[model samples]
Target: MTITTTLEPVTGPFVWRGDELSRTDDWIFRLGPDQVAELEEVGRRFIADDPDLRTVSAAQYPLTAAAEAIRRFGADMDSGRGFVLIRGLRMEEYDDTLAAAIFYLIGLHLGEPIRQNELGDLIDHIVGVSDKAYEEGGLPSRTRDKLPYHSDSSDAVALMCLRPPASGGLSSLVSGATVFNELLARRPDLAPLLLEPWHYDWRRQDPDAPADTYTSPIVSWTQGCFSMYAGADMIESAHRYPGVPPLTGPQREALALIEEITYSDGVALDMDFQPGDIQWLLNYAALHSRTEFVNGADFAHTRHLLRLWLRRDVGRPLVENFGKHVVVDRSSTRTEDAVRDTQGHFRIREAAAVRTDWGD
Candidate 1:
């Protein structure tokens, strides 16, 4: 039975920001000597094993802090704020190898690592790798550009800061729930557009990869919970494909409102990064962005970050047929024929709860 539905608004711990979350330090977990030592040891072991980046499994790199922090972090992602910052990583003490091992282990505790793309890379480098031409459809992470509020394509997205640029890389986060609530109050007319399956360009999602375009809802409601797959940059690029319908004027306005609220006042919680810090954001309930940054001349001084896009073996059920890693349904995947001429016949992955490394 085919059914078309709108996202039904729901409540959760994620529907908060500003005053509702005033203390920045509350979300921070500063590492003490014991935890730092634990990480350093893990890093040493990771390099000693000489495992390829792709082969580094969390099981081999364990953590003393894992049992408690990872447990709480999982719950927080599932039911709390949908985001957290792990502070006090001693990046200055270890080389890149050890530092990444720390990040990898923590991610493993949270969920299984998914390849960011067909290249099968487990870690993505988030730096201004190159200048993007106007036609390149630059991604904010790959360039020194500002990002509009958008959710990542994974169930959970994480970034570990290795270095910071000279200035202007502040991160901004807004609650998808708050954005939804404000829409209902201010622009109820345009809110439903999010529920409809929209075209999302993959592969060429950035300069690093090339692929095809697929369709999924920007906002999906399933099991009485709201899940979002929003990326203003990607959404805008989807229009370039002839297969996707051009966004309506009202849709543009709705996007504008989310961006407006994201920067407008106290709606988004902004934070700066310190070396060794990990920022984890739940792609489902939180929208995130960063300001443009400038790098200094020294290569060592340039900003370097390691990124991970995690998928739990089990997690929230999605209304749209979202797959394990890519945002599109694996089954209802759009083919070249479907994308160009045939519109709605794409297959969506059969709906089911994802079972993460952590038991459901």
Candidate 2:
């Protein structure tokens, strides 16, 4: 793998500061009334047909009313800002099943949804089922702990807010390019270390995996394009397993500086999620985080978000081993015959109680 150094700062539409972005509403795309009606009609039809999700395609459910808008959203994520917030779904009109169908329909237009877990689930639920931390054996998706800024294992990631928590649970995102440019300017010595191979815990993603850990560089530059894959918690946790080397002093300092840059003022953009709002992000261009939240006792009122990891039809170049952990299969071979329950809804509560797949 040839890792070239670029001391010159990366300048593009993707390199945006949060404080500057917050002052403008340009990143948000609101659905019009005609579009919402078209979505509702198609969503209900999808639930009625009940086709196998594994084989469904964008061609099967055409969204003529919103096709142009969806295409723009895709362009914005890929070439503009690396992220977009789509609002105005009118959540009160539909139940969980219909809501999921709408989210899935839009996702199909954007990209192919990949399996999110060993269960081969295309959609993963983000809800706090337990109060314990992930380090204590609890799943991060099922806990209320604050998640650190990290990239998921896919070309892009989309989240649809079905229910907002009663208290705090703001979703935040930081530009990986912006962070890298700042680091290069402030700590040039540490920037090169991110290109070196680093060990990360694999048991966190799958308990029964053949290997306990996997290796990858935090940053990669190829063909004049830059990509990033980061999760400091996973890098630090790799120390628990045997055969993995300990992090050197400079390596530790590099990790610290990266985190400091992400948390610095104007670096991370915070989004107060609203019901029916969906946020799409390019995984290589952005790292996302969430604040700890409080949920009500009622399961019906609990905070719930649907997550989809997509393999884009259009993608950027990457160096070798930069993102080897996530296997983006065209179709899942390990999923259950039926991912949803008899009531035509995903059994999120039951799945959360027993699921072991955990990552940011």
Candidate 3:
């Protein structure tokens, strides 16, 4: 397997500066009244049917009026800006069931929803369940820590805001291409190190995983296409396990430099999430993170979001084993048989409900 360490800097629409996007609303797609009404109608009927979440198809809830807009959204994430903020769902009018149903319906149109954990939840509830620190193995989504910029193991990831935090928790994104180009310009000597495989902690995933660690390069360039898979936490934590190679001095420097660049001025775009907003990002093109947040005292005021890891069928070319962390066969763990409550709603995992070392 040959790797292109001296690849030229990537250039495309996916390369963007956060400060530049801040001045425009092009990334935002506001749903129209008709689209919202259509979603509500379909969402209610789907909830009434209460079909298995995994078995439900997009055709069942045909978002006829919003189909074109939805297609454009896919285009934006794929070829335009690598992310989209969908605004305009009226949260007050719907309960948790309706909201989840609606988000699931839209997700179906986007791609196949994959299992997010060992329990096989197609839609994972992201809420802070504890105040534990990440160093203590606390789940990032279950704690109020400042998440670092990183990409998930999926073609695309979606988050629909069900409830916003009382303060902070601002979601931020940085273009991986932009970051790569900057690294090339500033320190070409270190750029090749990114194409070298680095150990990632697979123990943070399912206990039944084949290996305790997996290796993959940070950047992969294939057939003139660029893709990136990054998680500083995962790479750094892998060293704790036996048999994993230690990080060299240059590797440490490269990692530190990447993080420093991600947090540098104008690199990351931050958004204060609002209830009823859905943000979709192409994992290969951009890295996302969150600010430390404060949740309210009551459950009603708790910060909550619905997450989806989508296996998009779009033919985006990628190098072999680029995202080895993503689970491929979920047939045994699929959420088709998830239990439901008397209210005909799937039980959502509470905050801090995840394993401290769980990786997603």
All candidates: CA RMSD in angstroms? Answer: 9.1, 4.1, 4.5
| Candidate 3 lDDT tens digits, 1-360 | 122335677777888899999999999999999999898898888777777764567877777898988999899998888999999999998877788878888888998877665555577667787756767776666777788888876789999899888888899999998888888888888988888889888766444445778888998887667888888888999899988889999889888888989999999999988999999999998999999888889876788988888889767777767775556522344235434211122332221132343442
lDDT winner between candidates 1 and 3: 3
Ten contiguous residues with the weakest lDDT in model 1: 346-355
Model 3 C-alpha lDDT versus the unseen true structure? 0.79
Clashes of each: 10, 0, 2
Output the lDDT of residue 71, model 1. Answer: 72
- Give the per-residue lDDT digits (tens) of candidate 1, residues 163-226: 8888888888888888887876787888888777766666456432344576777777765567
Task: Candidate 3: list runs displaced more than 4 Å.
Answer: 1-6, 205-210, 329-360
Worst 10 residues of 3 by lDDT: 340-349
- Tens-digit lDDT track for model 2 on 1-360? 122346567778888899999999999999999999999999888877776676788899999999999999999888888999999899988777788888888988998877665546677788887756776866667878788888887888998998888888899999999999898899888888988889887777655344778888998877777888898988998888988989999999888988999999989999999889999999888999999898887875678998888888555777888864555453644335434222122332232232343443
TM-score of each: 0.83, 0.90, 0.90
Best by lDDT: 2
Cα-based lDDT for every prediction: 0.67, 0.80, 0.79
